[model samples]
Target: MCTRYRVGASGKKLAERYGAVEAACDAPGVEAFPKRRGWAVCAVKGELRLGTMGWGFPPPPNGRAPVVNVRNLASPFWRDALARPAQRCLVPVTEFCEWEGEAGRKRDRWFSVPSLEIFSFAGIWRQTAAGPVYAFLTCAPNALVAPVHPKAMPVILHPEDEARWLSGNIAEVLPLAAPFPSQLMALAE
Candidate 1:
């Protein structure tokens, strides 16, 4: 579900890479955890801007848990965000971790796109009562992530698709929710 990931670069570097204006905020650190603030590039007033947003949405009415990895686009909870380009965001990431092994013995397995020093996940953000929060989409795992996290993997966007994800209509961006190419990804030792 990508509960944890690494940014691995300064805010200035990330903003530069995404062609966004940097916000005056503290760095989110190398490793990011759920509910913590992390850097996200969002379109504001038709301009891409980089800023920090808390991970995960506020708990739903049923009080299940904070929504993190969004997989169901048809759900009422996520539909509005999916239909609006302004709510779409780019989650900067260097590497993401998935746990392997049994409950007590599980160990983290990190994966990264070998060709990108920094890549982005297809994300969505919203203004909640607690403030702005963000979550990335997930899809069925690929050959590389399936062994470690068979259920799902974050939707890592290709550099070319980043713009489409942020501005394209639902029809244009929905197809991008598929898994990234396994051959282009590397599992860290």
Candidate 2:
């Protein structure tokens, strides 16, 4: 799961690239961790808008920490949030990191498609009592990520497919949820 990722561009550049308004809050840098406030391009009332949102869903009623990765689309926990296509958002990232090592000796390795300066994760967001919260989807890891993290990796949307992910129906977005092409990604030590 993508518990951490990187967002290095300024809000103005993100807004311009994604055709959204500049976010009004601070943007994260090379290392954005879960539960932190970050900027995402979300459709507000059918218009794409860049806004600051916490990178997690609200804690469960039992009061657990917020969840950062959401992979179960069929689960009741996310059904209401995922039902509306408008809730979809694009999480801009330079790369995402995965840990490699034993429990206390883990080291981070960053992964990205070097051919593109920026990319987006298929994300979902909603208004909560705390504020707006957003989380990205994850899928089984592809070859590149599987060696480092055998479990899963964030579902990255290709630059050309960003609009479809943001506006497409469940049927359209479902097909786009697979792991990104492993050959296109590069790893950084």
Candidate 3:
């Protein structure tokens, strides 16, 4: 799963790409991390709006790291948020990172389109006592990511599917929640 990602484009470009109205809020810089503020595109009252939201859901009572990558929509923890289409969001990412090797010796390798163009992750958000939080969905890894992290990869949405992801019903979005094609993506140094 992707715990870190890069969104290199300016807030204005992100808004333009998704046809969202820019909100007068502070946007995150090139690199984004868990618990940090970053931009997300969500439909509010049928209008696309771009704004900032914290990276993960509120931390569990045990004080472990907040939940970041969401996979099982049927899980009780995610059921309410997933049931509401209003909470669905699109997380624009230029690239995402995965760590390889032992914990102490782990190194980073980035993944993105071969051309390094912007892409998006299928996401969901919700209001919490702390504030609004968002998490990107993940699925089984594709060939490109299997060697590095065989468990899972983010549910990267195609550019053309952005609107449907935000507005479509469960059936329309379910078919799209799979690993991206390996041919269009590569590991960046």
TM-scores, all models, native as reference:
0.98, 0.94, 0.94
Among residues 3 or more apart in sequence or in different chains, the pairs in candidate 3 whose N, CA or C atoms overlap within 3 Å are none
The lDDT values for all models are 0.94, 0.85, 0.87
Estimate candidate 2's alpha-carbon lDDT, on a 0 to 1 scale.
0.85
Question: What does the lDDT read for residue 157 in candidate 3?
Answer: 91
Name model 2 segments beyond 4 Å from true.
none
Candidate 3 lDDT, 30-72, residue by residue in tens: 8999999888999998799999999998755765888999888
CA RMSD for every model?
0.8, 1.5, 1.6
Position 89, candidate 3: lDDT = 94
Which window of 10 residues has the lowest lDDT sum in candidate 1? Answer: 58-67
| Residue 119 shift from truth in candidate 1, angstroms | 0.3
Please give the lDDT score for candidate 1: 0.94
In candidate 3 the C-alpha lDDT for residue 122 amounts to 92
Residues 120-188 of candidate 2 have per-residue lDDT tens digits of 999999988889899988989999999899999999999888988888778778788799999999999
What would the TM-score be for candidate 2 when compared with the true structure?
Answer: 0.94
Count clashes in each candidate, considering only residues at least 3 apart in sequence or on different chains. Answer: 0, 0, 0
Model 3 clashes, total count: 0
* Residue 170 alpha-carbon offset, candidate 3, angstroms: 1.8
Model 3 alpha-carbon miss at residue 23, Å:
0.6
